[model samples]
Structures are given as C-alpha cells and as structure tokens.
Target: MTSQTTEATPDGGQLRVSTLELFFDLVFVFTITQLTHVFVHHPGWDAVAQIALMFGVIWWMYSGYAWLTNEVAPTSSGRRGLLTLGMFGFFVLALAIPDAFHGSGVAFGLGFVLVTCVHTALFASSGGSSAITAIKHIAPFNVLSAGLVLVGGFLHGWPQYLCWALALACQIGSPYLIDTSGFEVRPRHFAERHGLVIIVAIGESIVSIGVGLTGRDLTVGLVANVAVGLALAYVLWWAYFGIDDERGEHALSAVPPRERSRPALFAYGYSLYPMLIGVTLAAAGIQMSIAHGNERASLAAATALSAGVALYFVGQWAFRLTLRLPRPWTRLVAAAVVCLTIPIGVAWVAWAQLALLVAIAYAAVIIDDVITLRTGHHSSYV
Candidate 1:
C-alpha cells in the first residue's frame, strides 16, 4: 500500500509539467469553458443544479487520470502513447459539453464513454492481476453510467434529467467499488499534481481579468478597479499556495497512505468549488466595471458574485481544517463571510456597489492575513 520512493519537491525536480499533462489539461479548460457558458445561458437555481452534476462528471474523469498518472506514468512508453490517445477522447468530450445536454448529448456520451474505457484499460494494464481485477470492479459500473448518459441524451425534459442523474450517481459511487487502498498512489505526488492544476485554473482567471482590462478605456475609477483586482488575485494565490499548500504537502509527506488520501480528495480535489466560483465572480466584477456603472446589476448577479468569493474562502478554510494543519482557518472564514456580506448589504445601501464591495472584501482578506501573521498563530510559522 505504500512505496519507499518519494517524489522530489517543486524545486528539487523539474517544475515543468509534461507535454502530455498539459495537453490533457487543455481538454479540461475546454470543459470548464463549456460549463461556464452553459450555466450563463440558463442562469438560475435549476441551471446551477445541472452544472453541479456536470462538475461531478468532470471531477471524476480528472481524478481517475490523476491517480493513474501518479502511479504508472514514466513506467512505460506504451502507456504514455495510450495516454495521448485518451487525451483525444477527452478533447472530444469537452468539445461536446455545451451540446451534451442540449443538442448532441449522444456525441458527448459516446466520447465520454470512450475516454472512460481508455482510462480503465490503462489502469488495468498497471501491474498485475490485482490491478486488473481492481479496475474491472469499477469498469462495468462506468459502462452502465455511460449508457445512461447516452440514453439521457436522446430523451427530453425529465427523462433526460433522470438519465443524467442516475449516470452521475454511478460516476460518484464508482470509487467505492474498488479496494482503493491497494493502489500505489504516492500521496505527495498526487496532492502536488492537484495543487498545480488548481494554480492553472486560478492563472486562467487572472488571464481572463487581464484580457478584460486590456480592452477597456482607462479612467481613474478603472485604474483603481484594476489595482484592486490585481491585489485580490494575489491574495487568492497567497491563500492557497502561501502556507496552506505547504501544510498539504507536508501532510501527504508524513502520513500513511490511508490518512493521506483524504486531503487529496476533500482538500485538493474539491478545489473546483472555489476555483469555479472565484473565476465567475471575478469575471462578473470585470464586466460590471466595463459597463459604465452598476446599472446592470441584478440580485442574481450580485448574489453570484458574493457566493463566489464566499466559497473560495470557505474552501481555503476547509482545506486547512481537514488537514488539521498549523491553523484552524476559522478567522479566515469569518473574514470571508463578513466580506461577502457587502454585496447583500449593498443592495440596500445607496452608496454601496459591486466594485466597492470587491475592494472592501479583498482588503479584508489582506487585513486578516496581516492579523494572523502578527499574532503568529499558525503552526507552520513556528
């Protein structure tokens, strides 16, 4: 269940992600884009529910590959070639996402099923009969889920929803079908891989904001907005990688396999909750700035932006709390919730607006960090 080998730290070994990993990640970028677009088009609680379901699907695919790559990558040229082939299916599935539930669910389902099969084969080919047998336990379930997706794609309304619902259930439960304890997953490597991917997601958010900034005509307010936005991004980066990531890395480094696995799943793997929300809120904030003033603000938009900021901090809190690291992160959560209240309060206050709310919320995060530092409460600090 454990291995003597330890992966090199980011500095000790190459920090560069491999070409194949980048190519594989490209598909996920496309998938996130599709989910964003689809969610935007619908824009309500129902759409949020559907997007949540789709996100589960996305998370499972990525999680399976991550574990597989951690175990078997660099072991064989043959496996690497098949990985490239699997990435192709992922690309197709991503491209089919916007239409997955809309126009061509069949195309999406088939592509997804194909990707799952490819991954299943790769895992089965891992080491011996145990690996094959372990993977096979989950493979049939994947096939059944894929069939549901295909059938769901063909139907309309509730029937389609039902198919996807069942499919998602199967997908989420698939991990339980195997004695995952036997997998030779080095916790440090797995955690580090996911932590890097999250950075990639956050980088995309910065890129999105940068792109928006470039196209707009600059005003005094616009300049201030840009500064605040940049500051906010930096704080988010600090919140994740600053000390939290180190603790996660250390936890994985110190713990036995069974205990170490939880951080990867609950802490790193669930990061989409924050990453997605932060990006969406930050994007909406950019558009709000570009739109002359807060004239376009709606309760829905305000709530979305507020929820996004809140979730990112909550995720940070959860990441720390789950690992029982240097800090409890309770103050961080309190600050985040207090900051998030700005948007709701703005709805009632004449002077309060989205831009101002963002500025205040972001400032609070910095203040909270400063206080934490001054108090020297973090275990990592000592």
Candidate 2:
C-alpha cells in the first residue's frame, strides 16, 4: 500500500495546499450551509440524526479527497480537472441536501455516485503504485456504498435510514478493511488542509449571526446577542487553533509515515463530523435566538444552542484522545453542565442562555489551560 512514486512537493520542503483546492472549498462552504439549513429547519433530536446520517456520508468523501490530495497533489492540469469534477459532484450533493430525505434523494444519490467515481478514477489514474494498489483494495467498498445510497433513494422511512447508515458504515470502516500501512500522509499538507476546512466550516457561525440581523432594527439586546455569539465562536476557535491543531500535526509528524494513517483516521477523518455538525447546529441556534431576541427560545433552538456546544466539547475530547494528548476531563464536565442550561433557554430569554454557553465554554478553556500548565504537560513545541 505504500506509494513508491516518491513525488516531491512544489516547494520541495512542505507540500502546501494548492489554489485549486481552496477554490474547491467554496463548494464545501456551500455544503456546510445546506447542512446548517437542515438543522435550522428542524432543530431537535431528529435534526441530530439526519445531520449525523447525511454528514457522515458527505464528510467521508470530503475526508477521502483530503487524503487523496495529500498523496496525489493537483500539480498538473489533468489532476486539477479531476478535482474540479469532484467539486461539481459536491455542489450537486449540496443542492439536493435540503430535500434529500424527501423528493431529492435520487439527486443526492447521483451526486454521491459521481463523487465516488471521480475519487476512484483520480486515485487510480494519478496516484502512485502504492496509491493505486490501495484504491484497488478500497474502491469496491466505495462503489458499494454509493450503490447503497442510490438504493436508499428509492426506499423510505426506516429502510432509507438503514441503507444510508450502511453506506456510512462502509466508509467509516474502509481503513481497517485493509492495512493502511501502505497509505501515505503528507503530514503538514494533510493537517493544514483539514484545519482550513474546519476553520471555514466554523466561520459559518459568524455568518449565521449576521443573517439573524436581517429585517431588524439596531437595538441593545440584538447587540448583546451578537457579541455573545461571536465570543462563543472565538472560544471554539481558540479551543482548536490554540493548541490542538498544532498538536495534531505534531502527532502525525512524530509517527512513522506508514503508521500516520491511524492517528490521521481517528483524529481528522472521524472526529471532524461531530465538530462540524456542532458548528452547524450552533450557527442555526444563534440565528434563531438573535432573530427573536426578546422571546424564550423554542425547544429546537434551545437544544441547538446547548447541545451544539456540548457536542463540540465531546468531539474535541475525542480528537485529543486520538492524538494521545493530555487530559480533557474539563471538556466532558463542560459538556454536561452546558446541557443543563437548555431548559434555561426554553424558559428564559435567549440571550441569557446564550451568555451562559459562552461562560461555560470560556471556563472550560481556562481550566484546561491551568491544568495543562500545572501538570507540566508542555510536550508539543508548536
């Protein structure tokens, strides 16, 4: 499974992500927007289930591209073209997301099939012998997953959920089906690229706040809501970028290239879905709360505001575990405490619950920082 191609990056030092890949992320931005919309429309346990199911499939492919590009850089015109084709498929998938479980399942299925095809074709055609061999072992599972999604499009209710769940299972289990010891990870590029995607995905939170401002007069309550929402967003950003982002890169770089896939899988590939889903839910909740600043939040809005932050902490904890980082007990405690405030959002003013979420998040960060400093856990120099 190891790539014998021995390709060097353009800089011959670090293989930085290319402009075309950044351009491809515009499609990713749209995908996140569509996902957020799904949550905003149906803010509850059902939204959680739908987002987990749909995004599980979507993020799997997105992660596949991240790994694909990590190995097969889009340095040539042909590679760039294939990457663009994949972007188109992603756009189609996003377009279908709003109604995917209703009348648009087939559209999403078609897009999923196209994305799978392009990923398989690009990996087989452009990758090194190691990559080709890896794809050979991996592509059937991908095609079968795509077929399951297409089949799910024609089914309904529990059957549809079952089929799509199987598709997602197929993806999540792909790495273990064969030895990923043959896979390659350009550590810096892989880490930085996934970091870029998460940053942009979370940026949607700020956008959601602005969207909340539409058609409303400038008022102090609205101002406070926006400020607290932004503070929560900053808290989330600092939680990742402040320490864990660099730690993730360090963990990957510290490992042997062949063994890098394990941390990369658990840390980046698996953990990203919950983190991004939290962003989507939090963003929608912010929009709703800010839009109705004077009223008590709905059950859905309250859950999104509280559970979204909880999920982020949980996801970050999982990520730290995979990287074998220091204790994240504060994250779990913070998550539990935040969930207690959902009833507050349901009964009190939205801004009160919103501010409480920010407070809990900041406290978690400070506590984690103090514990890290006291325990002399300063390992990663980044």
Candidate 3:
C-alpha cells in the first residue's frame, strides 16, 4: 500500500522531502521550544541533567525517522497516518517537558513509547528486505529503551535517572550491538532532511529572542541587543549551511553503502545531538541575556551563553572529523575560545558577552572558508 506517487524528485536521481515531513518537523521544533523553557523556568544543575537525559532519548527516535524515511518516504496514505501519529507523540512529549521530571513523567514516557512503536512499525512495513533486517535487529533495542523511559517515569528520584541513563546507554550501544552495514542511506535526501532539522532548531533559537522581548519596552538598546542576537543566529546558520552540510552530503555520497553507516550516523545522529543541545542552550541563554542586556549575567545565563556556543563548535569539530573533512582546527579553536568567555559573561554586561561570542563565531567561519579554498574541497569530498 504505497502511494501512487513516487518519492523521487522531478530530476529523478533524488527524493524531495515531502510537505508532510515538513509538517512533522514543526512538532519536533515545538519540542525544542518546550525543552528550551525547561531551563528558562528552572535554571540549575537538575534542569541541565534532565535536558541531557531527555534529549538523548528523544533524538534517537527523531533521527531514526530521518533514516527511516530516507529509505521509505511517506508517500502512501498509510505511512502518512503512521507518521502523523508519530508527530502527535512528539507533540505530547513537547507538552510534557516542563513537568517531565515532576508530574508529567508518565505522559512523557507514554508519548515516547508511542513514538518508538510507530517508528518501528513504519520502518518495518515499508523498507526493502535489507532495511527490514536492519530494523529487525534495531527494533528490540528501541522497544527496550522506550521501556526504560516508561519505567523511569514511574520512579521519582535518582532511580529515575538510572533508568533513563540505562536507556541512553542502550541507544548508544545499539549501533555497535548489531551489524548496521546493511542500512541504506541515499545522500541527498538524508543530508537535506538533517539540514532542515538543523535550520529549524536555529530558527527556534531566534524565536527565543522574541520570547525574551515580551513585556520589555521598545528601546533603542533593546532593539540593538536583539539585532545582535539575530546576528549570532545568522552566523551559526551560515557556518553549517555555507559549506559543511554540502561537504557532509558529498562525503557520504562518495562512500559505498557498506561504509556509510559510521559516517552517516556520526554526522547526523551522534554529532548533531550535542549540536542541537548547544543550540537549545544558546537559545535559552539568548532569551535570558536579552532580558538583562545591561546587567551582568547570572551563573546559569553565563554558562549557557558561553558553553552553548562552545558545545556547538565541539559538535561541529566531531562532525567534520567523522566526515574525514579537514582537521577542523578552526572549530576546535572557536570552541576553546568561546568557553573562556563564561567568566567574562559574568563580569561584563550581557550584550558585551554576546558580542564577544559572536565575534569568535564569525572568525571561525572565515577560517573555515580559507580552509575550503586551500583544499579546493569546499563542496566535494576530494
């Protein structure tokens, strides 16, 4: 029961991401907004850990769908229904985030269970034999991790963390637990899908600036500070979109399928998880920073502001390394430099700290461009 329509683009060699896929992503970004607010409402160590644990589990399935649909697009009515159900699951998770560690844990877990189930069924039904085989090996791990999340929801303290930790461990180990060499990855759709996700996350960050703007008088300084925040978002957007995404796609496409699992998984899955976290953290930071542009930062705001940008570069460093792109010294240096600004953020005004961080980000982009020119691999593998 596939759709009468083909998933292929008019050009025929690649698949265009469907409108339904884009609609599904709207829910995913909503989850990002909710996760961002978890920190906004409660800025502390607990909030940070909860975000880490929750994101790890949530992303496993989110990225899993990207992989699923790369091979099996929801061109069919049946697949679309299943995907829409999965989207509802994500919306439930989004609604649960503020209270995930409190009263809403069960609902969060239930949503996760639903997401996992739909993902497995959707992938299992529509894939070719090899993909089905891959999903067969992968499905049990997914089920077990979802179970842990549900069990963790039942508990209330350190015990809950342990269950979720175990769930995260299972997800991390699943790729190694089985042979994933049989997994299919078409470079164009895969890269485009991920690129769209990344952009959505960045867009959410910009949305946070607006959230921060609420209730503030429209002043010149406030408007200027907001402008700088947008600049930071733009530079981050350009860094990924300018050359690296294309490079990533080109790198994966250059490799045969048997060799793609590692690079593809790292580029989109493992590496982007932390990168997305970084963006979320930065968004929260921007929200807080914009509210007090003239005042020195609080500990949470300082850490989020400095470390968020640093974490993004660290993830980018890993992404480039996994793709066997140039050594990514630029990203490494940018990461280190941004981290050093936490204390400065605490000591100086929020605008000052943000300006400094954006400067470092802009510098990294210039260096990356220079690297691309020297290697002549700006858009190619080699």
Per-prediction TM-score: 0.80, 0.94, 0.95
Residue pairs of candidate 1 with colliding backbone atoms:
none
Most accurate candidate by lDDT = 3
Structure candidate 3, residue pairs in collision? none
Q: Write candidate 3's Cα lDDT for 269-367 as tens digits.
A: 999988899999999999887878899999798899778888888899889999987767778888898888788778878888888888888887877
Q: Candidate 2 lDDT, tens digit per residue, 124-168?
A: 887777778988998999999999999998887889889999999
> lDDT of each structure?
0.62, 0.83, 0.86
lDDT of 1: 0.62
- Candidate 2: list runs displaced more than 4 Å: 1-14, 374-382
**CA RMSD, predictions in order:** 5.0, 3.7, 3.1
Show model 3 residue runs off by greater than 4 Å.
1-6, 9-14, 379-382
- Cα error, residue 49 of model 2, in Å, equals 1.8
Question: Which 10 residues in a row give candidate 2 its minimum summed lDDT?
Answer: 1-10
What is the lDDT, from 0 to 100, of the residue 154 in candidate 2? 81
Q: Which ten residues in a row have the lowest lDDT in candidate 3?
A: 1-10
Q: After superposition, how far is residue 109 of candidate 1 from its true place, in Å?
A: 0.9
